[model samples]
Target: MPMVPLLICDDSNMVRKQLLRALPSGWGVSVTMAANGMQALEAIRQGLGHVVLLDLTMPEMDGYQVLAAIRAQGLSAKVIVISGDVQAEAVRRVLELGALAFLKKPTDPQALHKVLLDQGLLDPSQQTVAVSRAVAEPVTSFQDAFRETINVAMGRAAALLARVLGVFVQLPLPNVSFLEVGELHMALADAQGNAQLTAVCQGYIGGGIAGEALLLFHGSEIADMAQLMQRNSADYSDMEMLLDLSTILIGACLSGIAEQIDVVFSQGHPQVLGMQAGIDELIRVNQTRWKKTLAVEISYSLEGHNIHFDLLLLFTEDSVERLSRKLAYLMS
Candidate 1:
């Protein structure tokens, strides 16, 4: 059989260049590029490719709109959403719209290849398992190792945040759990119920970093966070204070993770949302298709400090691919 043709759609030439650079060599695949969704659709309509690598945030016609149009036309081509938007609702929405998979920005080459292979777009003969493990071995050992790593990383993050706020930080013991998409609502509900204050930030991390990261706070710690940011400034409103706190806390957390992961993340502006309302809306939006769950939860506390925040590292299915690649490398 002839190799599959791949279509990459992104507004950024830089991103397109990176994708070309990162794709595996000798894949017997033909790659084509488009500047935006309209171009992508036009290419598809011309039957130029059987698979599409799509970006969600394009001008004129975004990935979502393109996907809707493709479905309306009953296109058979497989689509993989390559985006930086990590919002649960957004991921869920795209996957529901018939996307074959979702790969977050800065995708790992090994993982992407595996996704292609799993979808039968790439020949299995060209694939290799990056990690060596006995088939009979229980998977729990791998989970244990990853759980420890995440605990250490989160612990360092909590410490860094505590220092920035000059308050005591308490972190819950780490737990390893797998979740289905449908169970996401329950998982997020439980996470939100215990949180006192929530603040979110969007940014990019790693080489060519271009993605969003959210830092959630508990309700009780909201006031403390406001106070910490206001300590040095006099004329800041509640909203301003919240934004400042998000900047500080998210910066600290991202810095700590970067140090551990050996990656650099560029910071972006912070956005504060109504805690309960935001979580509820997210749950409602994703409840339909994201019923299966797979996530790791960590809790931390800032004691003797005015604000307490819970840092959640929410990972979608695409994140799992990224995590698997990272873990394989670490194990190696």
Candidate 2:
């Protein structure tokens, strides 16, 4: 092959750079970059993407949309999806939509290399420049690195939940922000809308990282959740369903993050913050306890179902520097 035209599509700058560095050293390819699906489609249209590496959760257009477009437009781009969303449905859907393969997040270089070789995209004997400089370059900042970390953790959580519920989880682009108590209230309002909500809060502390995990469920959706969980009406109540969900999502998500940053956390007992309360009421009860926080929000929806919930990871302001140091060490 003279040169393969490859496109790397992901919203994270860190992820894009990592993929570039992960390319086979001797692969003969001209690489194009896209931050979202629209750009990826445009690049393919321009003949810049004979091969596309796609990430699933992105703003504007997601990987699923890109795959659909590639099929609809009769484009010849061979798409290999790379995403943190590891749900079984996610993999099945990508393949069904015309993706050549699906790889999990925080990609393995050897695995990627093997895939390329197996797919005849690489020649085993070829030798090219090493990615030493790319290796040396750390992620741009703590925020970007932290957000990407959450992105991966979010997927792990969703995957577990999807497995337990036997439903496809629709993932959102994680929302990360540093906010004051007032701003946090506003953000919660936007997330929950006017729905009455029930929430569970759990605190975790270790390795100089301390925060609370809050899982919010819409009041009207608890019955839907109960149905999906296949709960015995005589055996489980709405509150039981809520706590169970909190345990699965919050535990898996925190464990995922901890595994990446090399931290071990001791978790506090889950507290029922409120049931059938408005967003304002929920925040008011906790307002005095939080001043400033680093908040990571993930809204997960069940495919073909009306069930949706928001999981918020709130790190204390004091924990930011310690977490930053941890990420810096990991990236380094």
Candidate 3:
């Protein structure tokens, strides 16, 4: 039998490059590409591939429409919807529409490969449990203690950001959960749409304890931020102001966490990007680098004011594992 063929349908060339890089090396399969749903359908009609990696937003036709079309034609190929638009309703709809699984953009290569294997589309023998039984009894005391510790560390980060901006900043206690990269994107998008600006930063924590952190901000409240920074109005453009604010917020947040945890850390400068771009562009940009997405969302409020913004921190698999280990140690 001929080796199976896979089709990758996405609008961005960058994302295509990343996906190609992330896929397992020896899957005995060939890959094809399509820029939109219409092209994907044509490729399928031609009997081109056995698997389709579909993107949700495209210029000509969206992923949902293509999925419906595929089902209508009774095409037997499996589809996996890969996107950064993480609304619960969207996930629910796609599942109902017959998409086999959903992977967020910047997907982890290992996770994606495992999903493929689990579906029997690939020959790998990896198995993932949806829910694992706890090996030890629940420790409520340590859980509460660590939660409080993280809260204080986050607060200190907020205060540092406020000092840098010369405004009062509020860092809300986050609702913690184990999140994949796609789910993190959804949460950030929901928050970003409601806020003015968002800033993102990535870095590791340590002193023998290490992990990653992300910071976000609201762009609309530039005036307040400028006031806090003690900078004159003529000093910055909208984008420049946002970048500067990110540098400060990220720096402070990381520094604060280090102090509270008694862990030492160093950071890289912020790489500022627009989060309000169209979903297609965002997916395209991220797909160039990451295979799996692991991120954290932190919300910030300006003290004595209604101004609020979101912070998103992204990490690679290595970083995530390191953080998980640290969290486990702290809880223990």
Candidate 4:
């Protein structure tokens, strides 16, 4: 039998390598790799592979786009979706877009092998290592601790928002990173696809720590948010609703996070960065102003509703060392 073509797509080199390692090395499969959605689609069009291992959150393009391209062009490639976003809604979205399977991150080898076998893509004669599942949980590190810390804070924020609007909010897995400021916008997968948005910015300082919190909403979110607040959509301006929503969500979230970290924050008034502006035009500061920053991002959506938004908290590079110390203290 001829070797089958398999394409691995992910932005992280480490993840791609891990995916390769998880497979049987002796299988008659020719592996090709792509770093992002565009590259993945190009490879498929070029006939480099017929089976794709696609990741959801990537800079430049996301898995949804790649899957859509596959469906549009009548490509024969089969896609298995992989991501850390375990929300049932997120999984359902990927499957709805033409993915053949979904696997959450840090995929158990047993489960992965089972997926391949069930898909009839695994060769029974191949030799593969039965790796042990003895590794400590990946979410145990300081980074992950910070993620969990913000996750709890996010839940509090959701509850507060729910009470204020009397509507349930769809929570997402928070993404935390220490990355270059120029690369910050690329970190938001849910927000990047929109053509236009309205964003609000607020400053906060306390306990010798300072940073900015950004609340972004898709252009269509204003109506849903206003309706949730039980207001006539035509009565208030979009900016008014945007600021009000940002104040409630960002204020509660920041306070909850500060309390957990044993700190305090004095928040500044919400500033309308832009209403109905492209994301690139929303940033009031220079892109490269800070070489790097510590950031926490949460993509929040309303359950059974079309409302969705993202919250990004960015701290200057100088503050991260101190922040790391605080995270370590909390871990202890």
Q: Give one clash count per candidate, in the order shown.
A: 28, 0, 17, 0
Give the alpha carbon lDDT tens digit for every residue of 92-209 in model 4.
7789988889997655677877888888888766646233332221223567556656765776787678777766666666788887755665654235465467668887887777
Per-residue alpha-carbon lDDT of candidate 3 for residues 185-261, written as tens digits (9 for 90 to 100): 67556654654545454445455443344445555676666666666667576557766767666666566545645
Candidate scoring better on lDDT of 2 and 4: 2
Q: Which runs of model 3 end up more than 4 angstroms from their true locations?
A: 1-149, 185-215, 259-264, 275-295, 327-329
TM-score ranking, best first: 2, 4, 1, 3
Better of 3 and 4 by TM-score: 4
Global fold similarity of model 2 (TM-score): 0.90
lDDT for model 2 comes to 0.84
Task: Sort the candidates on lDDT, descending order.
Answer: 2, 4, 1, 3
Candidate lDDT values, in order: 0.62, 0.84, 0.61, 0.73
TM-score, candidate number 3: 0.45
Identify the runs in model 2 with alpha carbons over 4 angstroms from their true place.
128-139, 185-195, 233-235, 275-289, 329-332
> What's the CA error at residue 40 for candidate 1, in Å?
60
Q: Is candidate 1 or candidate 3 better by lDDT?
A: 1
